[model samples]
Target: MQRAFLPSFLLLSALAAGLNEARAARLVAPATVQDTIVMRLPNRATLTLTVRDAAQLRQLKNYHLDSLTTRLATYITQAEAAAKAGTTNQVTMRFYPDKDQPGQNLPEEIRITAHKPGTDGEKGPTKTQVFLNKKFGIVTTKDGDGHNSFSIGTDGNATANAREDSLKREKRRRSASVELGFDIGLTTLVNSSSTASLQVPSYNNWRSTYINFGLFYVQPLHYTKKSKLAFTIGPEFSGNYIRLTGNDQWVQNGNRTFVETAPDAKQIQQATLYVGTLNLPVMLRLKLKNKEDRTTLSAGIGGFGGTRLTSNIKTEYRLAGTDYNSEDKISGTLNLTPWTYGLQGEIGFHALQLFAKYNMNELFKEGQGPKTHLLTVGLNVLGF
Candidate 1:
């Protein structure tokens, strides 16, 4: 009887063990195929989720799968719209596991962040955050920064910034500025009769040291988008030094002017005539190149009126073969013109200008000396 009871116990134990093994096999068996969902976030990150089994995939379909897809579609639509409008946007979605299957592994919440197109209306970055309920505890995972970041598009709207910058530059270009210029040229007497007793020396004896310095207020005039003109008015200080070839004294005999050689004159070291004037110049300049260009071509025409500040004749001499030297500066003795007027013209590329001027008035007072005009040709160095 004890042997029979032992066999029954062994058989019962084997059956129970077999049943437990079958149950474990059913729980651990792999599903026919795995299903997955992939989501892309605004910040260029990817989120991939694998369903646990066929039952879990079915549950997702029956529960909130369609609604989730719909919500995501809505978010994309809104984000695209906002981008078109040059704005930013965000979206949030909830993914709930089936209440009937509390033990099912499913995400609890999903948050989507998107941005509108940038200034150019192009698609921007996105971010996604997923909250999951795990066996250990609730866990949070993020694929991106979860912030909206926009991209600049190629649309015309992007030009707004460029246009603003261009406007600023244009304003500066059109603003008022101070200008300075230097002039150097040959100074000579014109329209003089050769037989005149008070004739100035010819060009061979003339000094090419005429210099002028100017300071001006320049105002730009804009007539069109690409065209510009300027009005410049300035004070110019000018001086002319004329050197004579011979040792001669310029003498005034009551009313007549003559150059006389001294009896003791052996060698004429230097004889110079100096004239200083303060002039007022009015000019109009037309620019031939676009204002944006670094180098521009310009043409200018102007006139000047001036008063003679001072005039003098200086002579330096030495006795022939002797160390004796003499120098004399005679001022206010030459009957020079008290007033002067001239027409000036210039052509330039950028800062370098070639200029010419012709004096309309005589260099000396009428009937006091030979009738002569002043002609100047030189380079004008301009600065901003």
Candidate 2:
């Protein structure tokens, strides 16, 4: 019993370890420089200041409109620069007081003064700073061309405050992660009446099973927390077995014609097919967070294109349901036609998912007498 259970135990243990590592990676922060705050005075002079994460976003409520504006402008400028440099993952903001501002009814303005992460002559690691002026509603980055930078909002004070609060909340959820993982799954082909003919109804029963394995990479989009994109590549193999039974009589012109020399009934045929496939799957994954911790609701749709590498078929026929009439085994490529397309979906825990796929292509090439399809259900594991 221990010997038989060894493989299952090892596979389960490997799955658990891989999932933990992937989850941990998601918590690590991508490398980035600290953000600086800046504000441009109505007098046209720019002032530099420091406002931490929450403080920076609370301008509409805690700080003067001028102050918040400075920080907001600096924040966005720095964010854009960071993205261009491929250093930061994403940047966002929330403007509050949402209603129109009273004082703003008059011509008033504030702008960013300097751009942070200033262009150091050399083009290597340059540190940018943001200047924030609480007194004047201006924001500037280390890179801005002039003091008339940009305004965070002309909305009501309350709305401005709300916007700042939203920005603070968004900054907290941001993260960058890298993952690596694998999944092993199985698939089976079921027998159906639509695929068989009357003469071979009993002898042409067919069913097949397969084992597949794969690897994947995943990246999440900040605009939508529910979805991510992933690419998976893998190899798979399948074993097909078929059984057929029929009356010893042969049919002619849709008429039941019995052979005088043959017995009333017999086992007509049996066959086995073996094939291998190489697949590349691309998919968009949607995830939902549950109220519970360490658990996530996940689903995805994947499209795969693959080619069959090897396929062989063998068959046996018996007469009168008793004596073997002929037996043949062929190693040549059966008309798997080499191409397959499918869509898959599933729900699962972090890094470990289970999905089912329905192949859209016919099993045989065109002009073949009968038609067939392939269906697969398998476990999908992701690392990211």
Candidate 3:
């Protein structure tokens, strides 16, 4: 009888030792910020676990060891299963301390939730809850709202979503845009022939006005992330008015052009010439700042070439100085060039733009009239 009892006791002792070894194998050191725990699930998926605070660290190291690990492993399995099934892989788990033992040195209630992929099969948002004290807890999520009860996904996808959003905004900003604007400028004759007797319009009496209506298509040329420069090209209708002093009218005799007092006119009041053209303008516009506010500084330089559409001269005179009521309107090409080309520049602060233009081509055909260039200066009333 004694020998049989001894054999049973030894067998029981051996079983107890095996149980102790297994328990020791499962135990681990408390988690710290420097340590990251990685668990490989049965489905060949990985779950990375982290401790956010001291209380969480203590709970992970001590209380409900088997229960917590089992729950986490189950969550990992479900996430993988959802991924394979093409469904939402989100999982939420809530933990609460045992209510029966109020004085126990155990952690308070906590929640862990993982987000699922969005419609595009990418991870959505994540949320983690940590109890800092018995009465307070901290919740964090990729979205600003932290009060959400469930965390849907992992944090690995937050950065990708942010990058996608940024790209979309940039694409919208770089899109092509069209704008309408009006241009007005002062004009004068330049680079005239020395031998020509045609008097240059006096600065005091010669009033040059350029009025243009245009539609511009602008494309942004990005040199840097914050830099803004644009290429602009458009078509415009321009009407140029030049008022010559005194009652003089421009006349063309064969190959010579001259200005003289209008025939049968006494005391000329006003003599004006109008030239209309259709212009194609190209420009480079630069902004000193990235913002569109009116306080920013901007500059532009460009050139234009076009064909003259019409030309006319108007004369107003005083018949023997009797109230100066006579008026005459004439329409002709006046030997003006059929085509025109010029260089233009603009500078402004915000919406106010000042412009200047220098015509490179002669105002009239070769040997047909006085050789003169046109210069224009004025303001752009409708900012582009």
Which prediction has the highest TM-score against the true structure?
Answer: 3
**Candidate 1, position 162, lDDT:** 41
- Per-residue lDDT over 164-196 for candidate 3, one digit per residue giving the tens place of the 0 to 100 score: 465456456556789897988777888886444
Segments of candidate 1 deviating more than 4 angstroms: 1-166, 194-196, 203-206, 223-227, 252-256, 261-264, 290-292
| Overall local distance difference test of candidate 1 | 0.56
| Residue pairs with backbone atoms closer than 3 Å in model 1 (clashes) | 42-125, 42-126, 42-127, 43-126, 83-117, 120-153
Better of 1 and 3 by TM-score: 3
Cα lDDT, all candidates: 0.56, 0.41, 0.59
Q: Which one wins on lDDT? A: 3
Prediction 3 TM-score vs. true = 0.55
| Comparison by TM-score, 2 against 3, better one | 3
Better TM-score candidate (1, 2): 1
Poorly placed runs, candidate 3 (over 4 Å): 1-172, 203-206, 223-226, 252-257, 262-265, 290-295
Write down the lDDT that model 2 would get.
0.41
